[model samples]
Target: MEYFKKILRFAKPYRVYALLNILSNIFYALFATLAMISLFPMLAVLFKQTEPVFEKPIWNGISMGKEYLMEYLNYFVTQKSESGSPGDTLFFMVAIVITAFFLKNLFGYLAMYFITFLRNGVLKDLRNELYVKTVELPISYYSEKRKGDTIARITSDVLEIQHSFLSILELVVREPLTILFTIIAMLSISAKLTLFVFLFLPISGFLISLIGKSLKRKSDKVQKEQGYFLSILEETLGGLRVIKAFNAESRFSNTFKKSTKRFYNFSNSLLNRQNLASPTSEFFGIAAIGVILWYGGQMVLVEKTLKPELFITYMGLAYQILTPAKAISKASYGVKKGNAAAERVLEILETENPIAEIPNPIEKNTFESGIALEDISFKYGEEYVLKNFNLNVPKGGTVALVGQSGSGKSTIANLVTRFYDVNEGTIKIDDVDIKNLKKESLRGLMGLVTQDSILFNDSVKNNIGLGKKDATLEEIIEAAKIANAHDFITALPEGYDTNIGDSGNKLSGGQKQRLSIARAVLKNPPIMILDEATSALDTESERLVQDALEKMMRNRTSIVIAHRLSTIQNADTIVVLQKGEIIEQGSHTELISKKGAYQKLVEMQSMG
Candidate 1:
């Protein structure tokens, strides 16, 4: 309910629709009670038990509204009895009852019709807002979360909210109003009987509430287990090749089975609790009906205190209350289940994004001087990955950082692009601190190409144009040519329109790397960060990709993080790092002459 209150604002926009629905429901509830009460007069005519009334129907100096109503009905029946025949009176009463019932259903349908807009509107807005928030959240958020869990939130849990929570508007509002109007009609007929009906209600309600007490907690556990199994299934599908290659099918199957077994037990418990609502509520309502019969029968058979027809109408009204009461019992269970899903969705919508742009940030257009990492330090957690790091790549100069794995080579590239902020010290670009610049303006001046070719399942033209949206077709071709991807693209059946399958799996490793280069080339920013761009390629592919990289880096300020020694041999300055500290810094030839860390790295690579 707390999370539901948070999402109430989304439903505000559709208040007009909800209001119309409520109005329709109000009329429907009123008419439904009238429909039941109308049958009483017809029963009086059929059973020949009509009450003979006095002129003014004034009883004990108080005007009985029921007697006045009965007087009016008797006047109509008496007029028709005099006009043609007794059958005419019966025909008139039947027409009135049938017309009232038809109208009851008509308004009921209209209420549901109007509510459809409100239900689907909330669903659409919830899904859209979830999508927007998912993308706006920082990348660091995903590092600690499973992708499948997020997927379940947006898909399964949201759907549950719609079904359980949003649909409550229909059942909770209309059905309860219907019950209230019917109860009022019953009370007007005989307050004592209405009071008796309510006496049984509280006991039934208490028992129903008891069944739903732990439903939310159980539902939350079940949803979490569902996500766990989904994540395992996602992982199994993604890594089937590894599982098969290592002959670990049984191992993964056992793990998945364990997860699913827990899901099964939890799901069964949740469903078992929910399944209790209908039967228990119906059983209690039936018990109340039995008590109504036992007591009301005495009033008719022995005391002669109540007329048979009015008692029959009273029974109809009492029976009507049972449905909404049962629906309320069911809806209570639904609310409990929806509470869990609502909490999950609100957790995402209410999450504070850690890497958002500052208020009134600087708007730098282009780099003029260079990018500088001045005594910078960073860490993913408590362990420092980059400590006291210092580097300068002047405008139009190429500086390469060559080191073994875990030496913070890629961290330097990440900091340069502000993909992450440094924990200590500052990174300045063009003599301005990066924190001061608008993130968009700062990123507009740079391009990045990671070793994993991050190509989507899109067309070749679209993938390249991502670097510079709205780029012309000719510009795309020119960039592809610069990346040495034009030949392969042109050879494809659809050329630029060829769909690069998932992660460009349709293309070769070299072809994919070339396309990634083409994307960066199309952007043509002043500064570029290539993080092991050719690391995963074979020798031939590396040479081609490296050649394309060299071409792109020409006359551009580039920070290259390379694992291979040969690729950065011609860099203007090559920095060597050890244990998050700069060990050597000079031109490639100068570093080789020093016979230091750089020399030892080159020697080891040559022997390999």
Candidate 2:
């Protein structure tokens, strides 16, 4: 219930719809009760239980409102039957019932029409917020979470909340108000019998509550198993190539089958308990009706304390309670299920972002002097990848970092881009701490190109122009020519408008890498961080892209993490690293002359 209220806050924006729904429901409930009560006079005339009043009844005060209305109805029926035909009176009574029912259904439809907007509106807002949060979360958060689980929350779980919680919300006013008005009608006809019906109702309510006690727990299990299987599906689709290469399709299939089996069992248990709501409430309602028939029968037939027509009408009103009672019971089950889903959705929405910025943070838009990494230490776990690491890059100077795998070369690039802030120590740019600057402004001054050329399934022009919004066609072509991609792009089926397919799979490795370079070149930021951009390319492709990279880095402040020793020979400064510590730092010529680690790496690469 607490979680349910939290989700209701999303309804604030759609309060007007909610207000209209409530108003319509109020009229619907009134007509629903009146629809049944309107048939009382017809039943009285048909049963011949009461003598028709030929004289008009005097106006009665509010104290005798029920009695006054009864007398007026008898006098009206008497006037209709004065033509010596009771058929006319019965027809009039049926028309009154039909009119009451017509108004009841009309307002009922209006209520549903208005609630639709509120329900879907909240769904849209909730989904939009979840997507924003998913993107805003740090990359490290996904390292421990499943992409499919997040998708389930956004897609299936949110829909469950809409169907369960929002549907129950619709019933909250209409069903209970129906029962309230029906009970009022019953009590007015016979207060003694109405009070007698209460004895079994509490017992029925208690039994219904027992069925829903464990519903939330079981519902949570079902939703979780669903997320688990969805995660497997997402993983299987993402790694289909590797799965087929290893011939492990059977293994994945068996794993998915096992998850689905558990889901099947959990869902069955949940639905069986949920299905009991309707029959259980209905059975209890009939039992109450049976008890009323026995007691009210003796009062009307044997004791003669109750009027036959009034007792018959009271029975009809009591039956009306059954429908809303069944609805209320079903809604209680929905509440439990919705509460479980609410917790899952709120888990994502209520999460606190660890990467937070200060109020009124400084906005540093340009890099002037240099970037300084002083006394920095970082660790993904207990063992530090970088401990007390220090380095500096002067403005417009190209610095190359050479190291083996797991030697913290890429870590430097990640820190410089603030993808992951250092665990300790400070990174300063132009004498101002990078953390002090607005992240957007700091990133605005830098461009990054990674080993894998990340491209979307869009036009060649759009992919390159992603770096600069609304860039001119001539400007896009100019950037492509600088990156050595212009010739290949112009040869494509649609030239710059060619669709790249998924991750640019339609293009060759060299062409994709060149397009990535073109994107970075378009941005033209003051600082460039190239993290093994050509390590995955063939010699020919590397040569072409390397030429483009060198031309682009001529005047930029570049921090190049290189895997191939041949690529960084002309860098202004080359730093060789081992185990997160620099073992050598000098020009490529000077490092080769030193006959140390750098010379050994160059020899090893040359032999390969």
Candidate 3:
């Protein structure tokens, strides 16, 4: 119920539809009672009970208001003479019953009609908000979550809320109101009989509540299992080549089968428990009906205190409570199931972004002499990855970082982009602290080409144009020419329009890296960061990518995180790192003359 309140804010825009639904439900409830009461007149006439001597009058005293109403209604049933045929009165009685039923169904349809807008409206806004949150959240957030779980939350969880919980809102309002109207009519006939009917209700309610107590726990398990298998399916599709090459189909299949087996047992238990509500409630209702028959029969036959026709009408009203009662029981179970999904959705929406920008951030218009890191330190966890690190890249010059794995070469690139802020000291661009600058303005000055070329499932032109949305086709081709990717791209069947097919799988690794460089070239930022851009390629591909990379870096301040020594020999400055500290720094000539860490690394790689 608390989760429902949180989700209700999405419904604010559709209040008009919600109000109309409530109003229509009121009419549906009233008509449902009228339909049941219509049975009374037929029961009286068929029992030969509505004769002039014995038609039960609605009022006892001769008050003008009550007397006038009673006479007005009796005018049509002029007590068929005792000698007249029963068919004379029975025809009119049947007409009243049919008319009552027709009006009930008509109002019920109207109730559903008004509720449709509210259900779909909430669904539309909920999905929109979830998508916005996913895009707005910082990149670091994705490092800790499973993509398929997030996907399940957006698609399947929202659909559950729509079909299962939202559909019950129509019944929640209408069923309770229908019960209220029917109970009031029963009291009008005889308060004592109505009182007897309600005595067993609380006991029945307690039993139904027991079944739903564990439904949420079971439902949460089922949804989690759904995400687990979905994640495996998503990964398998993306890495089918790796899986087939390693012959690991049995391993993935076993993991998938285990998750599905848990889902099977959980769904069976959850649905079976929910299914018990209908029959359990019905059985209790019938038991109550049997008791009422014995007691009410004594009142009519032995005590001669109640009329048979009125008593029959009272019994009909008592039975009417069962339908709505069963519905209420079912809705209670639905709430339990929906609560789990609602909590999952709210968890994402309510998550506080840890890396929000400052209220009033600075803006650096341009990079001047250089970017500098002064005693900067950082850690992805407890152990610092970059401890007291320092470097500088003068504008229009190249500085390269060479280090073994886990020595923080990539962390420096991440810090410059502000993907993760430094923990210990300040980083400045042209003497201005980067922390003071607006994030977008800081990122606008730079372009990045990483080891993995992150391309979308779109056309070659669209993929490159991501760096600059309104870039013309001619501009895109120019950038690709600089990247040395123009030949292969033009050779494709659709040229620039051909789809890349998920992370550019249609292209070779070297071709994809070239395309990534073309995107950066299209952006044409004043500063560039190339982190292992050519390390993953063969010698031939590396030479080609390196040549294109050098062309793009011609007039830009470039920071290259390199693994191969051959790539950085001509860098304006090369820094060698070990154990989160700088061990040597100089040009290739100066570092080799020092005969220290840089010289040792060059010696080892050259020998290998």
lDDT of 2 by residue, 1-608 (tens): 89889999999999999999999999999999999998887788788755678999887687677888888887887777787578887888888999999999999999999999999999999999999999888777888788888998999889999998999778888989999999988888888888998899999999988988999999999989989999999999878989999999999999999999999999999999999999999999999999999999988999987888788788998999999899888988998999899999999998887766778889987678999999999887788989899899999999999988999999999888887889999999998888888888988999899998999999999999997997999999999999999999999999999999988989999999999999999998999999999999999999999999998898899999999988888899999988888899999989988999999999989833
Error of 1 at 370 (Å): 1.1
lDDT by residue (127-226, candidate 3, tens digit) is: 9999999987777788887778888899888887886678677887799999999888877776777788689888988987888899999999988888
Question: Scored by Cα lDDT, where does model 3 land?
Answer: 0.86
The TM-score values for the models, in the order shown, are 0.96, 0.96, 0.90
Best-matching candidate per lDDT: 2
Candidate 3 stretches greater than 4 Å from native? 42-48, 51-72, 79-99, 163-165, 363-365
Sorted on TM-score, highest at the top, how do the candidates line up? 2, 1, 3
Off by over 4 Å in 2: 83-85
Higher lDDT: candidate 2 or 3? 2
Which window of 10 residues has the lowest lDDT sum in candidate 2? 42-51
* Full-model lDDT for every candidate: 0.87, 0.91, 0.86
Q: Candidate 1's residue-wise lDDT over 66-146, tens digit each?
A: 777787677666666667787888888899889988988898899889888888888899999999999888666888888
Say which prediction, candidate 1 or candidate 2, comes out ahead on lDDT.
2
